[model samples]
Target: MVLPSVLNADFGDLGGELQRLTDAGARALHLDVMDGHFVPNLTFGMPIVEGLRRHTDLPLDVHLMISDPLRYAGPMVDAGADMLTFHVEAVDDPAAAAQSIADLGVAVGVAINPDASMDQLEPCLDHVDMVLIMSVQAGFGGQAFNPIALERLRSLRNQYPDLLLEADGGIKASNIADVRAAGCDCFVVGSAILKSDDYGKAIDELNDQIASANPSGANISPGQEATR
Candidate 1:
């Protein structure tokens, strides 16, 4: 599913932006919450979340890139975040942290950086609802998608048939097919959708692109790792 990231959206006109996305066939919205320490950046807090809750009916797929995910999970969920994805690098016991957040009546997702190994992320797979493999470093948006992410996704998909895999960073109409082919069920799109001339049309094009990609396996053709 194409989950448009708020990080790249027009905050000045978020209401209209949300409406446009909903009309463009978006099933959910990806909200990136960054703390200055954990991600070297700062973004939406609970106040923003509370405000965002009233604007859309689409499920809020909140990604917490913070130093203290467990401490803030409840507040974010309480502010109407439907699903919370916390970075594994921030916590000591990822598995336990995942369950602790899950207990807040929301589906838990765990995110891993591009440099993280597959085995390091596997321990939390059984406990979380989804796994978000960051295609770029976790701090900011609009960075290039790392080719290593495809290998990580491929390895994870090959090993866990039931797990839901997601990919974020530098994904757009061009390389989306490759990412999908690499076994990402959820696509967290940012500027790819936001910066387009026609947001709805761009989203439609992306969805169509994803629909056309082979879903059976990571039949990655030689040198298919896209630069975009």
Candidate 2:
């Protein structure tokens, strides 16, 4: 599934931007909630996520790159986050955090940074619905894609075989196939889609590409190809 990260969307016209993406066939919305202390920047909070919830029917894939994620997990779920992800580096008890988020009836996810290993997520894989592998450092958009992460995704695929592996950071139409082949099923694209002059066209092209790559049309594999 292709989720367009709202971090790069135009805040001045959030509703319009969201609607455009939704209309363009985006299945999910990726919300990056950051705290300056955890990552070097700060982004949307619970209220904003709640507001976005009312604008679209698509599932909200919330990535919380903040400290004390356990403290904020409940509120984010209550505010309508369908799937919540917290950095593995941000919490001490990642399993507990995943459980807390799951308790709210929302899917749980764990994000591993560029420098973090897939081994760090091994203990908590069963508790999460997905594992987000960052292709670049957190807190910024439009950064270069780290090719090393591809190897990590391949490793995760070989190990888990059933976990949903998502890739975020520097994902665009041009490199979607490379990442897909490397074991990424869900893609979180930021500036690539939101910053484009032809947002709708770009999204269409991406979806078409994804479909072309996986003709079997099965749901996306945990780390391999996306099921059509």
Candidate 3:
């Protein structure tokens, strides 16, 4: 499904922005948590997630781009995160990390950068509920779309038919069709929805593309949402 990334949303008016996305048919929200050490950027922490949890019912898909995801996983989950994703590049034992996160009673997710491969995630595939495939370099927004992500998503789908695969970065209506056709179960969109003049219209247009792209006409029907 379409997961509107909060990284591009107005920090001054996030509640209203979230309400607008919900009304626009977005089923979930993607929160990018970056630590300077891991991604050369630092964003808000649990307080923001706590505040957002009080403001909306939409599931919070928290992506932790931190050096130590295991350190922050529990706190994020306690802050009302429904799905938690961490970079494989950050930890040595993916299975142990995934198990720990899964034990917290939320959907466990694993993410890989554009340069990373599906083989890197094989160790934690069965432990994770979803997988986030970064199309652009992590730590920034508004980068150009990368087609290599489509190939990766397709590769993941081939290996695990039912695994929930997500694609983040540089995604928009123009290329969403190809992304969906490549087997992305969730699309983490930033500026395309946040920068639009009309949130509802932009989301509707994306849904239309997702609908028409797949011959099976399946919705982004995953057990949870995903992130950057």
Best by lDDT: 3
lDDT of each: 0.83, 0.82, 0.87
Question: How well does candidate 1 score on lDDT at residue 163?
Answer: 74
Give the residue spans of candidate 1 off by over 4 A: 215-228
Please provide the root mean square deviation of candidate 3 (C-alpha atoms, Å).
2.5
lDDT score at residue 46, model 1, on the 0-100 scale: 89
Q: Mind giving the per-residue lDDT tens digits that candidate 2 earns over 1-228?
A: 788899999999998998888777777889999999999998889998999988777788889999888889889977888888899998788887788777887777899898876667867887888889999999999899998778888988888787788899888878877777777779999888998888788887777676676654225422222221
Q: What lDDT score is found at residue 105 in candidate 1?
A: 80
Lowest summed lDDT across 10 adjacent residues in model 3 is found at 219-228
Query: Which pairs of residues have clashing backbones in candidate 3?
Result: none
Model 1 C-alpha lDDT versus the unseen true structure: 0.83
Residue 14 shift from truth in candidate 3, angstroms: 1.6
Q: Which tens-of-lDDT digit does each residue in 1-117 have in candidate 1?
A: 788898998889988888888888777888999989998898889887888788877778899999999999989989998888999888889999998987888888899998766
Please give the range of 10 consecutive residues that has the lowest summed lDDT in model 2: 219-228
The digit string of per-residue lDDT tens for model 3 on 1-228 reads 888999999989987887788888888889999989899888889999999999888788899999999998889988999988999999999999999998888888899998876688989998888888999989999999888898888998998998888899999999999999999888999999999999889988888898889755445433332222
Please report how far candidate 1 places residue 140 from its true position, in Å: 1.1
